[model samples]
Target: MRFFNTEGPNRADDHYSLPPLSRWDLDAILTLIEQKKYFLLHAPRQTGKTTCLLALMDYLNREGRYRAVYANLEGAQAYRENVDAAMAVIVTDIAASARVWLGDTDAPVLAREVLATTPHGSALSLFLAHWCQRIPQPMVLLLDEVDALVGDTLISLLRQLRAGYPQRPDAFPQALILCGVRDLRDYRIHASSEQAPITGGSAFNIKAKSLRLGDFDAEEVATLLHEHTAETGQAFTPEALARVWELTQGQPWLVNALAYEACFEQPEGRDRAQPIGVDLIDRAKETLILNRVTHLDQLTHKLREPRVRRIIEPMLGGTALGEAFEEDREYLVDLGLLRRDGAGGLVIANPIYREVLPRALASGPQDSLPQISPTWLNPDGSLNPDRLLDAFLAFWRQHGEPLLASAPYHEIAPHLVLMAFLHRVINGGGRLERAYAIGRGRMDLCLRDGAVTLGLALKVWRDGRPDPLTEGLTQLDAYLAGLGLDRGWLVIFDRRARQPPIEARTSSHETLSPAGRCIQVVRA
Candidate 1:
């Protein structure tokens, strides 16, 4: 039976998938290939770039217009700076793909022979030239994960392609498409022997255009869910369908993984008689996040990168990044970590990601938190806001300092530690939602347990900045009003150079907002 595929390129008969070609401008792509133009196709990992390339190769070969092959150069990554070894593997892989897809053995044999006799720098070019000469039709090559080859290997491959570009359609491949997670121009190839970094554009200036494969649109997402319904007679409730879209924002891997988990993994989900509902979808999303599934984990791992940190730190902390953050912002957007919201401001790509980022950042602190009794729960199992406040006050006074020191993102250490404490308190039976934006100067968190809801706003008083007490109270007032609550907490974190220690400063006092709503002010 066909299922949502999470592993690799989707096969029509084996997986429920959207049409690959429909995801891009097929006419524009064909025009590039027909014009013998070398170009690029890039998108975030697991977004189906490989699937689209495979489909395009199959289409071109079946149409008998071009002898097309899709070659994955990822295997050559192990050779790193060994240009000769990497190129040999890449050339052999391309030849093997050509023979498998086009059923032409002569091309592979001749190409391998040429690689054996050619110099290390010109080996790939000579092999491609020999292979193209043997083929009757013009060759179209899609080199997948081209950027995976680093240092001297990457430089050699790009240079070879450029060296052979002028002889296309007869001597070299008629057209070439390089596919990877980022644009070729974004690559900063560092060779061990070179003192300066070599940009990919300098190596391959012949690129005609860059095409990005996007995530599924709302309709496409719905169509994929509908395919499961059509096949199994089990329907997704309207809310569940919408929830999936909201959580995934049409990210292809996430859409498939969530559906697969809902319909197959959970025992309750496997019951065909039971229709999928929003609650089930929510559970699936929680499972995906907490377990740190491969895709989401891979994304969060990028948080440690300096470039990624510059863009993400400010978004998480609700402050503006430096003036030089534009390139980093664009880089994060290209990696699918950040997206341009309707207002053109950068935000986490989706609701799931919004939740994932902070939680992942706080995971270390959360794990280190000392055990505490559930003093916040009443006899009837409802959370008591006053009791929770007492627990947070005591916990913050005791462990907050050590925990903050352990947080990965230093700028938001206090916030991470607080969220970690709250996450521990609310783990099994409650929900915590976060909202923050660049220049907002605050992070708002809403915690819900059964019928009880609590709103807490967090702000930092950094060096050269005024105390955020008044601003936070006003912000908390609006936030509480939005949540339809008459009370909430405004937490001001003093981060000035000469501020008192956290233990000495940790305290809370009752205050009133400008709108006359009761507010609990926590100075930590």
Candidate 2:
């Protein structure tokens, strides 16, 4: 039976997948290869880069024009700065791939001998030179995870590839495709022998173009889900299909993971006759976020890097990004953590990431809180918005300061702490949706539980800024109108240097918005 694949490269025979080559401009890529131009293929991890490269290799070999091989260079990462050791592993892997995919044993045999005799720095170029010379057809090499090797190993590989570019067809591969999570221009390698960092562009100046493998389009996403319905007769409701696309924004791993969880992992969904619904998809999204699965966890880990933090901090704070933040913004876009919205403003890459970022940031603060009763939940377990507000006020008065200190993104600590408390309130029975963006000056949240839906707008009062109450109320009015609720909360966190203590200043007042929606204004 075919299933959604979340692991390595997807095999069409075993996994439900979109056509790999369909995600790229195949004509352009083929033109590059035909011209013998070395180029790059890059995308975030688990986005089908390997699958596409393997498909291209197969297509090239079947055309009877080139001897094509795809090799994963990740194995060389273990050797780190040991260039010679790394080159040996890389050469061996390339040979193994050639034998498996191209039925070429002679190339590996020759490569092993050549590598044995070559020096550390020039070993890769020498081995490739010998192997290509022996091949019957012009060689097309696809090196996957090319950026996985760090330090001297990475510099050596790129430099060697560049050095061999002048000798083509007969002495070196006719066309080389390097694949990794980021473009070559973004790579910063610190070689032990060099005093300064070497940019990948400097090391590999021969790159013709960098082609990115995009996520599935809406039509492609529908086609993948339909495969399951066609096979098992267990259909996804139209709403479920739309929800999946909205949540994932066509991110490959997220689309597959959410579907797999909803249709395969959930016990209720195991009955083949049952249709998958929007609620089930929502549950699956929550499950993935709460578990911090490998893919999402890997992204969260990047938040610690200073470059990553610079972009993320301003984003969460809703402040304007400075000119200096441009490079970092581009870097995050390449990593698939952020993307340009239609208006060209920066936003989280997708809804799932938008949800994951704050939740992951709040995890530390959430862990430090003391056990408290779900005071806002009614006897029948329905959420009471007014009671919830009262409970939050009490919680903030007593414990909010310490929890804020515990948050990882200090610029948005108050927001994170509030979210952590609200998450605890709605843990089992409800869902929370967050929306924030660069220069928005506020964060909007919507909480849903059964028939109760609450809208909230959060603003921070920073130095030299007036109290944001009037603006916040206007925003909350618009937010409540969108949520179809007549009442909502506008939380203004006072973050100025000489503010009174939180316990003494935190208070709430009720007011009417310009739209006349009842607004509960909370000052913390």
Candidate 3:
């Protein structure tokens, strides 16, 4: 039976797949190859690029039009210091893959001989030239994880492929597909003895196009799940599917992760036969974020990359960076990190990602902190604005300094703390509605209990001011209007000055608004 493929490549008939090669835009890729165009296929890690390539290789070879071979160069990357060792590894891997594909181990004899005769500096190019001469039919070469190579090794591979580009159909690979996370322009290759970049584009200018393997579409996701249901006689509840769509937004890893967790890791009392629902998905999302695995951590690592931060930081601040947003927003969309919402605004792709992003970016002594439930100020289940604000003030008094001092994402510390506190309070008990976009105004959190709801707008004032109340009131008014609520609370942290020691006392009171909505302030 086929299991969820969280790691490694999926073979042709071994995995329960989305048609084995159903990633959208396959037609365009095949068209590019048929036209004898060399191109690049790029996508973030684990979005099924390898699976797509394997299926494509099968299709081409089965058609008997040309000899196609797909080899991943990642294994050779570890031998960076020795070019000969690296080249030999690449050749050995390629020969092994070629033999499996074409039933002939000697198919690349010319390629091997050229590498043997050419000097170290020019071996790669010479090998490609010789390989083209030996292969009778046109060749299609698919290089996976091509970006793992660094320095001279990477440049040599590109240069060799480029040198043999002119000898298509009769000799060199008719189409070469280079696959990696980012394009060649972003690569900065420095030779061991050289201080400056090795100029990658000069060696690999033959790229006719760059194609990204995108996340699954909504329909594609539904089809994949439905296929499993058809085989196992199980079903995902309609709400569960909607929740999956909402939380994952069709990112493949997330889709598979949520499904696997829901099926195998259900809470002790939950029913197994009934379809999983949205609430269960919400719970699964919480578990995934709180106890992050490697796949999620990898995306969080990109936050430090300027291209990612250029679009993310402003969102955290609730404002947009008009000029600094030069990176392709669509590329972020393709990577499944950001997406255009119904309002056409760019936000973190989905709720699971939204929750994980902040926690992942926050560095220092955090995960060790106890996960404590919020002490509700209201007796009846509804949040008392005055009491909730006071609770935060009290918590911040004791733990704020130490936590913020060690925090890596200090700029967003207050928001993270407040969210973490709120999550503890209402998590699994009631609903907490959170809506934040890049560079808007303030982070809005609505704590709900049946018909009653309490909204709090958390803002940071870096300016040298003792009070942000007046400025916060204006923003809170707009937020309340959007939420259709008459009254809410504002929690403003005065970061410009050192907060008074916990030994001092503070007061909480209700300030009435012109709209008759109640405003409470907790001065800590």
Q: What root-mean-square deviation over C-alphas does model 3 reach?
A: 4.0
Stretch of 10 with least lDDT, candidate 1: 192-201
Q: Per-residue CA lDDT of candidate 2, range 380-450, in tens?
A: 98888889989999999999888888998898999999988888988767888998888888999998888
Question: Order of candidates by lDDT, top first?
Answer: 1, 2, 3
TM-score of each: 0.97, 0.97, 0.85
Q: What lDDT does candidate 1 reach at residue 340?
A: 88
Q: What Cα-based lDDT does every candidate model obtain?
A: 0.88, 0.88, 0.71
lDDT for model 2: 0.88
Per-residue lDDT of 413-481 in model 1, one digit per residue for the tens? 999999998888887688899998888889999998889889999999888878888888888888999
Off by over 4 Å in 1: 186-188, 192-196
Order of candidate numbers by TM-score, starting with the best? 1, 2, 3
- Winning model by lDDT: 1
Query: Relative to the unseen true structure, what is the C-alpha lDDT of residue 518 in candidate 1, on a scale of 0 to 100?
Result: 90
Q: Write the per-residue lDDT of candidate 3 for residues 278-315, one digit (tens) a residue.
A: 77777777666656777788878778766677777668
**lDDT score at residue 8, model 1, on the 0-100 scale:** 90
**Superior by lDDT: candidate 1 or candidate 3:** 1
Clashing pairs in 1: none
Candidate 3: worst-modelled 10 consecutive residues by lDDT: 363-372
